[model samples]
Target: MFDPTAFDNIKFMIQAEVYDRDLAGLFHVHSRKDLVDLATLSRESVITFSLKDSADLRVSLVVKADLEKLAGELLPSSNALPGVSLHILYFGTERSLMAERMDLLEWMWGTERRYERKKIDSDQTGTTYEWHVYFERIITEEMMDELGDLISFIGESLRTVTETE
Candidate 1:
């Protein structure tokens, strides 16, 4: 049986290169107070943390049981175990930029994008796009060993790409 507490605490890290350094400048243009206000107004779910070197940005998503509904379909009925799902999302300055990067990553991993939508800022009228890649599987005793490594490998691969680019 999977520990619910452990699952609740699990956070996945995703890293991507910021090809255009000017994006960082955009953040600088606004004051800290203004930026906070913008973020509050924007209400973006994905929070970005940039490296000092300006090479890449890291985004973290906490695994939530409520968001695992789709994964539940793949669970075996014989067991009472709850299913876990992995969600990967990408955001960019432009809609096309986000879509193109998602396409390349999905192709490289052989995974299809699941939920995709444009998030419009109600107050500012600005737009941001999100592409969600989901993997669903039932947790099993034997699968536990390989599962950790698989997750780690995914995180490392993303980080490696950011480092190399």
Candidate 2:
């Protein structure tokens, strides 16, 4: 379960970096109060926005520098060094990939051995699933707290995950 409210916190930080040029710089977000160690966020501006469910979004960001290494691989045009603006497109690619893999795995391992409620109903309706992912800001308070825990865990710890059928 992913809380949509908690998403605001993450999306805000990202959007702030993209639209506001002055917001560009090296920043390290830490948990509890550990200025002792940090990771410097690369210096550059970033733009981000969410779109309607049915609408496809195509966007671009321009910056002052010609060296474009920081701008991401959005365009083939060589960019200025120490690039002024870096653009990252978030078109539900992450959530989609996660959903896709979950579907494939469940499909491959028919709903027999790993038994549950004796039935699994696949539907286009969003309300039917026990666990769901959303790009929209629709979350509960408990889920928000859970999200915080997940962030802290993921932020400070790094681990490798290997998937096998």
Candidate 3:
């Protein structure tokens, strides 16, 4: 019998929530990837989706657990905590909306998470802006129930972004 790691459990839960939304016609999943690095023994899951009402802005949810976190979960003597990092990515082309996005993010997630905007050069759009939402602390299994709320926030955030644009 193989016991799943904490990262696997959380990833599955997140997928279930996102897929349910997709099935409900609220969101359209764009891409999904579950990756494992053999050399580093790290695990990562990335899922991107767009709101059914607006495909212009896409939201990506990323979950990651490094080797230390995995070892801490599986080994009893390991001192490292079994914590996973969560990130929300927003993709858009309007740089002028930076202030609005910042306000929306602050209103949705407060000041707990860090935010960063990066500029990407593109042919289709003069420049694309990618917003990253990073959790200040790694998430543990104890906070699993909050995952659904996180998904809901993403959905609402997408809708808000579309309405403003």
- Name the best candidate (by lDDT): 3
Candidate 2 vs 3: which has more lDDT: 3
Model 2 clashing residue pairs (backbone): 18-46, 18-47, 66-79, 66-80, 67-79, 67-80, 67-81, 68-79, 68-80
Q: By the lDDT metric, which is better: model 1 or model 3?
A: 3
Tell me the tens digit of each residue's lDDT in model 3 across 1-165: 998878988998899999999999999999999999999999899999999877778888999999999889888999999979998888866743466775776677787678887878878768877888898887998889999998998998787767764
For candidate 2, the C-alpha RMSD (Å) to the true structure equals 19.9
Which stretches of candidate 1 lie above 4 Å from their native place?
1-58, 66-78, 112-122, 139-165
- Report the CA-based lDDT of candidate 3 relative to the real structure: 0.86
- Report the error of model 2 at residue 61, Å: 20
Ranking by TM-score: 3, 1, 2
lDDT of 1 at 60: 32
Clash totals for all candidate models? 0, 9, 0
TM-score of each: 0.45, 0.18, 0.92
Model 3, 61: alpha-carbon shift in Å?
A: 0.6
RMSD of each: 10.3, 19.9, 1.8
Residue by residue across 10-110, what tens digits does model 2's lDDT show?
A: 33443344333223322222111111112443332233222212122212221112223323323456452222322222122233324443454345434
Q: Candidate 3 has what TM-score?
A: 0.92
Return the candidate ranking by lDDT, descending.
Answer: 3, 1, 2
Candidate 2 whole-model C-alpha lDDT, 0 to 1: 0.28
Candidate 2 Cα deviation (angstroms), residue 154: 8.8
